[model samples]
Target chain A: MIEVKDLSFAYRTGEADAVPALRDLNLKIEPGQLVAIIGHNGSGKSTLAKLLCAVLYPTEGEIRIDGVPVREENQWEVRRRVAVVFQDPDDQLVMNRVEDDVAFGPENLGLPREEIAERVRSSLEALGLVEIGGRLIEDLSPGQKQRVAIAGALAMRPRFLVLDEPTSLLPVPVARRLISTVGDLNRREGMGVLHVTHSMSEAALFERVVVMDEGCLVLDGTPAEVFRHVERLREIGLDVPLAASLAHRLRSRGTPLEGDILDGADLRNALAAVRESTAS
Target chain B: MLELQRNVIFGQFVDTGSPIHKMDARIKLIATFVFIVASFLIDSFLGFALVLPLLALIQLISRVPAGYVLRGSRFFLGFLVFILFFQVLFYPGEVPESSYLWRWGFLSISTTGLYTAGILGLRVIFLYYVTTMLMLTTSLVDLTNGLELIFGPLQRIRVPVNELVLVFVIAIKFVPIFIGEVERLARAQTARGVPFDEGGAFKRARRLGRLLVPIFISGFARADLLTTAMNTRSYRGGRYRTKLRQLHSTATDWLMLLLVVAWMLAAWQLPDRLLS
Candidate 1:
């Protein structure tokens, strides 16, 4: 299990005034679970992600993995456990070639040559990037580069994967494919996932959703339960998915839809069921 | 043309199959020194005639284009022209034989002056081609490795050969990055309506100052991140380091090296008066 208990952070050594990037935040996540953290920009989503991966030490409180606290002494181990896919793919790719880039993390651990090769092949295969393994990272498209970044993290074989807006800048279809790939990894490989996103559509696909407001976790629950609090979500400058919005509007029009209509196809089916009932 | 051809020296590795490329870099460095000495020794017109053909033959064996060498030597050409003009116009005393190539007002040419200009120009050309060939064919890694090997004896005096090699590797890697950054900064300055070309000397200097601010800022930011990444990978100082590509000597390399040594000896043994 991964746990963050009352963690806060500040970056204040520069000319910029000291300001808390993350307030007193706390959360716990078990293995093999997909959790979505939704928040606007500068609402502490990225800072929390960095802290979880041990990229930045928490200024106060403690973070632990399986009861072992994350401190300076155990940072390398923590990093090996939790792999972070950064927002920018350019910053994450350490090598020029695709295969070399994917093998970077494993090589850093000083793995044997054969083992590194095996990990690189398996990671590329997992991300469906086997064909582009020999190509350079700069030659790949934005979506392909994002997949390559994910493959690099996968090569490390971390138990928990933290992605900070992995598909926020991608086209809608590419984002869908990336999230579906994440879903596959979560289910098939038994890896814990913390996907930070601003898209309501993407967040609705997660098993659990946590919303942040002004550097604090304001709400945390299942997607359906969270979306039910429509007014609260709006007050925090967030939105519900289109399907949920339409379902709520229909309910206000004296035609209630049953079950949580989060996806577009589900909403269509629910509307069809309602029409059948009215005809009868 | 000079301003545009500045990137020619930055021609990193073209993989030409020239004699310079075939020889071990250690041997090449020695050959370059010998060739430079020969150019200086042979100051007569006949000597230049022999040296130019030899330079051309070297270029042919390397398979690198001749235009590249010419383009890479632009600054050297300018400097050579300046030196030639100084020697021809201001040689202290009176001329023994005034050979008027072109009498343009106060400027008059003499046989000694013409000979001086020819020798100096030919020597400069020889130097440029030798250096260009060395850089074009040898990879930066191989060059550093060769340097370390050539200076291996200095290790007895506590010289840091490995540290020097590492520094060269890092410098070569950062050169391209720094160039790209300067290009970006220049573009940003241009976008701000700062005409870098149309300014007086001081104005141009001030414009450069404005451009450096952001470049340094971004460069420091990148350096901090790179240092963190390097530290995370445990990149300590080079001690007990193993290389992925080891330098191996071949029969062809040895043969070419022998030929160069024999030629250098023959040239040096030739009568000094004939050589001049």
Candidate 2:
């Protein structure tokens, strides 16, 4: 399990007025749990992601990966437990070829050559990227490149995978596919996923959703429970998923849509049930 | 109009499933250094003639097309010709009266000058080919590993050999990236009415200066992102880093090393006045 306690982070901008990016935030992610963190720009979601991977230390409180506190001496251990995939795949891929890039993580960990090679093969196969393993990263499409980035993280054999807005640079269909792949990995491998995104639709697919506003966790629950707060989400300048927004409009118009609709299928089933009741 | 991608092939690696390509990169690196030094030692045309068969044998073993390898050195070939012209025309070295072919106001041509120019051209070509072959066969990762192992001893003297190798490898890798970036920037500037190709040398250079600012800024931004990415992947320099592909020398590698050493010895002992 990954745990954060009263985490607060402040960046020193060399000015007297230093504003903290995160304030008194606490979170825990159990193994195999897939959670999404959604917020508007500058809401400290990315900062939390960075902190989870020990990229940036918290000014107050501490983060722990499986009871090991994140500190300087245990950085490699912490990183080995939690691997991060950043937004831009272009910047994240250090090697030219896909296989070499995936091998980078294990290589850094000083694994044996045979073990590193095995991890590279397994990671690429896990992502269904074995065909492009020998291809140059520059030649791959953005979606493929993003998959390569994920493969690199996977090769590290981390228990927790933190993706910081991984789909921000991808096209809609590509993003959907990539998220589905990530979801499959979480389900199959029992790896905990902490996905940071701005898309409510994307967050709705997660097992739990955490809403951040002004460096504080404003809402946390299942997607069905969280998307029910349409007004609060809009007030924070965050959009609810399309289905939830539609359901909210119908309820406000006195159509008795009695439940939170977090996805298209949920809205469809709910609308059909309402029609049957009205017809009866 | 900027076909920069097609034109810039120097230092680019081509994967040809050949024996030479499969050899350990450290072996190739050392052999290349040895061959280059031997090339400089051989002053006679007959020495170069003797080395031609060996070069051909390597090319055959590498399976890389001769034309493809030669094409990468096109730009250097032009520069070599320019230098050879100057050397032959000026004839800087002392010339015997009998050997002088022509002389006019600090410009002279002689038999020895022609021989010197030929030898110098051969040396340049040999150096270029050896280095180019090394790159064509070895990937950047192998190059980095080989260099670090080769220079591993220097770390005891407080030299940041790992970081230096990382910097060198990154710099080499960035060549194609920056070339593409420059192409994109030039295209954008062209769309914005900047005439990059219509000016004289100074004017073109001034126009290029405008392009450098954005490139440098973007380069810095990329470096920042790369550092974060690398750190996240647990890259803490080369202090305790292990390689996925270790360099193991096979029997063929040892044989090749032996052959290179023997060739260097022969070149050192060969007669330099074979054609004189």
Candidate 3:
């Protein structure tokens, strides 16, 4: 489990009047849980992820991962335990080849050659990239390259995986694939996934959702509970999920359709339930 | 001849199971030196005929098509022809030693100048092919590694081997990126009504200046980002850097190296005409 107590961070631009990105954010995430943090463009979601990964140190307060505080001395160790996949593949990918790039993390960890090789194979296999392990990262499609990035993170064998708007720049199909894969990792392996996204549908994939606004945690609950605050999401310039929007419309029409619908499949099942009730 | 030169330069170094490609790059580097030296020693038609066949044999074993090699060689054909023409015109014709091959008014062409021109042409052509073979078969990483190994002793005097290799790698990496950027800039300029083609030399120079500003800015930005990324990954200087795939000299490598060395030594000892 990870705990953050009054964590606040500001960008040091060598100025006296620097504005804080994350303002007194208090959050606690349980182990083996997928937590979705959704926010508007400048809502400090990315800054929060960076702070969590120890990429940027906090200006004030404390962040404890497995009872160890993330400070300057323990920064590298913290990062080893927490791997972050950035939004841009180009920014994260350093090597020319896919296997080499994936192996980079383990290599830096100074693992034995056999262990590094095994990790590379397992990570690539986990991402369904066992065949194209030798291919150039540049030659792969965007979806494949993003998977390669995920494989690179997976190779690190980090307990906590933090992804900052990873699906924001991807196409719908690619985004869905990424979400499913991340979800699978969280569910099957108990890999703690902290997915930072503005997509309401992506938030629905996670068990718990944390909605952030103006550098503050505004709403935090299960998808159904959090999404029920529809006007609040809209007021913060965030779009509600299609099913939730439709469910709200139907609810206004006095139909007994469930307002807990987040995905299309959920809506379909809800409609089936309505039909079954009417038939009975 | 010009066309052949271009083909030779351009063709050859793609990945193939060629003997040259399979050989250690260090040996190939040494062989190329010896080959270049042997070509310069070749002075006469007989010498050229002998050396040309050897070059052909080397190419055959390289497994790269002779036609492709010659296609690459064509790029430098213009320069080769110019050199040959200059030599033929400038070399003085001694009378009575050899009969005039051709005579036009005050100008007389003798066998001596013709022979010299032929030898020079052959030497140029052979050297070009040998260099192309070295480049085509060897990967950039291998070439740099070999260079570093050869220049390793220079590091004792603080010659900055790693820095030099870094420069070479960075140059190779940025060339394509810069070319793409230039293409984009040229299109942008054309769209803005700047006629790059119609400009005079000075006007063209001005247009190039305009193009360079954007390219430099973008290149600098990219370089900053790449530096940050590389540093974050802990890629310091190349000192004590262990490569995952290392270059090792095999039996074939040694054999080829020995053959080239023997040929160079024999050519050095032969008579001037034979050597040529």
Candidate 4:
């Protein structure tokens, strides 16, 4: 499990004024958990992701990967265990060839030829990039390049994978398919995933959703648990699904809606059960 | 409107699966070094006559289309010819009166000058062709690995061969990306009615100045990203870095090396004797 102990981070600009990006944020993500951290821009979701990856150390508090506290000396271990796929694929993919790019992480680890080859092959296969392994990265679409970037990270065989707005630049269908692939990876490989996104629908797909507002995590629970805070999420400049919004409004007007409502289907089921109970 | 990626053919590898393409990159690098040396050494017309066929043969065996060479060299070739004209017109060497074809004081065109210009032209042309073919056939990764393994002995002198190779490989790999960015920036300017194509050199450069600043900013930003990405991927220079693929030298590679040596020797010694 990856654990955060009251993690807080601030960027120092000028001497006296250090901008706080994360304020006493605590999160626990176990392996195979599909968790989404949702917030508007500058809400510290990405800050938390970077802290977990050890790309940026916390100004205060700690992030422990598999029980070891993340620090400068052991940052390499954190990197190996927690792989991050940043926003732009073009920025991360350094190699021209797809297979070579995928092999980059393992290559850096200095694995033997056979092991590296196996990892590259398997990673390519995992991302459905087997056929285009030899293709140039320039020739690939933005979505395909994103897939290649993920494949490179996967080759590291990290226990936790963090995606910080990976679908922001991708088309809708491509982003959906990529997310579905990521979901399958989380289940099949049983790696912990923290998907940091602003899309409410995308966040809803996760088993757990964490809401961030102004550098603090405001809500953390199942999607239904989190989405039920429609007015609260709206106040924080984030959208909620329409059904959840309706459910929240109805519950405010003295309706006995007890469960977390995520979608139209969940709202319909709850309303039907409520009507049947009233008739009985 | 500019398709910069399509326009870029340099430092690109064509996977033709040809005999020459399959040859070991170590041998290719060593042979290319020899070719560079021989290009400067072989001076006679007979020597060039002997070398041209060898390059053409290798090109044919590599299966890389000749259009790549011609298209890539068009501007360079034109510039070379123009430089050769000036070189012949103002030949600075001891131009004996007997070798002068037409005399007008310092502006005479001499047979010796023409001969020297011809030799210079051939040397540069061959150098460009051979190196271009090497790049077209050998992938950058193979080239990097080849250089590292070939220069593996230099680490005893604390040469940092692997880091140097990384720099070289990354620079070469960034060529297409850099070009694509220029295209994107240029197209963006064009879309905003900046008029990139409608200007003299001075005005064009002024417009390009606008593009250059952003390219540099983006370039620095990309370099930062690449560094962080490599770091997150656990890249710590060349030490403790292992390659997934190993290059093996086949009999064909040995044969190709042998042929290059034979050609070099022949071009060095047999030129005047055989042709005379």
lDDT per residue for candidate 1 within A1-280, as digits (tens), equals 8988998888773447977887888999998789999998888988888777776788888899767677877877787788878666765565556886676677667667788888889889989999988775656888999999888888778888989898987999999999999999889889999999999889999999999988899889898888888888888889898788778778888886888878789889998998998899
lDDT score for candidate 1 against the true structure: 0.74
DockQ of 1: 0.16
lDDT of 1 by residue, B86-150 (tens): 77875523555446555555676766677777777877777777766776777654676678888
Tell me the DockQ of each model, to 2 decimals: 0.16, 0.68, 0.18, 0.68
Off by over 4 Å in 3: A16-19, A278-280, B1-171, B184-205, B227-247, B259-276
In model 4, where do residues sit more than 4 Å from their true spots?
A13-17, A249-260, A264-280, B44-46, B73-121, B201-206, B274-276
- Higher-lDDT candidate of 1 and 4: 4
The predicted structure with the larger DockQ, 2 or 3, is 2
Q: Which sections of candidate 1 miss by over 4 Å? A: A13-17, A168-176, B1-181, B196-209, B229-276
DockQ of 3: 0.18
TM for every model, in the order presented, reads: 0.71, 0.87, 0.73, 0.90
Q: Order of candidates by DockQ, top first?
A: 4, 2, 3, 1
lDDT, model 4, position B213: 88
Compare candidates 2 and 4 on TM-score and give the better one. 4
Best by lDDT: 2
Over A148-210, each residue of candidate 2 has an lDDT whose tens digit, in order, gives: 999999999899999999999999999999999999999888899999999999998899999
lDDT of each: 0.74, 0.87, 0.76, 0.87
Which lDDT tens digits does candidate 2 get at residues B94-183? 856888888888898889999999999999888888887888788888888889999989999989998999888777777778878988
